[model samples]
Structures are given as structure tokens and as C-alpha cells.
Target: MERKKLTLLQTVFTAGVFSAVSFWYGFMFGRESARKELGGLIEDLRRGTAGSEPTPRSS
Candidate 1:
């Protein structure tokens, strides 16, 4: 039926969208150098990538 075909098409579209989004996110945030400096100047920056927590300071 047409309804069944439409449901199948929607399912495929949803799957494709999910796949593309996962691939894009992985490609964007999955590289070491993309998240970190190659070398040198690292000491100067000391930021240490995104979502990093700072060390606790002791009194």
C-alpha cells in the first residue's frame, strides 16, 4: 500500500539522517590533533582541550 511505502521511506530517511549526524560529529570531534596542539606553544596555552576540568587546589 501507499501508506506502507511512505512509512518505509520515512524510516529510511530517519536512518540516513542519524547516520550522517553521527558521522559528522565523529569526524569533527574524533581527532587527537583536532582536540590538542601538535607540539610547542602548548605550555604557553595550558588550556588542555575542551570539557576539561581543572585540578583541585589545596589550601
Candidate 2:
């Protein structure tokens, strides 16, 4: 019957959509985590460099 075919098509489309959305969200979260980690590392390095520098420009 036509109704059965329509139901099957709808189920397949929904599954495909859910899979794509899940993949996209996972990738997005991973990138956000990586960005935070890198940002923290850069800040730490900057602090370390500043700490090791000499201070004195008085004449």
C-alpha cells in the first residue's frame, strides 16, 4: 500500500537527519573543548614569559 511506503520513507528520513545532527553536535563540542585547552596553554605561556623577564627602565 501507498501508506506503508510513505511510513517507511518517513522513518528513513528521520533516522538520517538524526544521525547528521548528532555528528555535527559532536564535532562542535570537540572543537570548543580544544579551543579552551589551547587558550589556557597560551595564557600560561604568556604568564611564564612575563614572570621570567627583567623589569627596569629607570634613568
Best by TM-score: 2
Superposed on all Cα atoms, the candidates' RMSDs to the truth, in angstroms, are 8.3, 10.0
Candidate 2 regions exceeding 4 Å error are 49-59
Candidate 1 lDDT over residue span 1-59, tens digit each: 99999999999999999999999888877564444543323543566543455433322
Whole-model Cα lDDT of every candidate shown, in order: 0.66, 0.80
1-59: candidate 2 lDDT, tens digit per residue? 99999999999999999999999999999998888777766776887854555543322
Evaluated at residue 32, the lDDT of candidate 2 is 86
TM-score of every model?
Answer: 0.56, 0.71
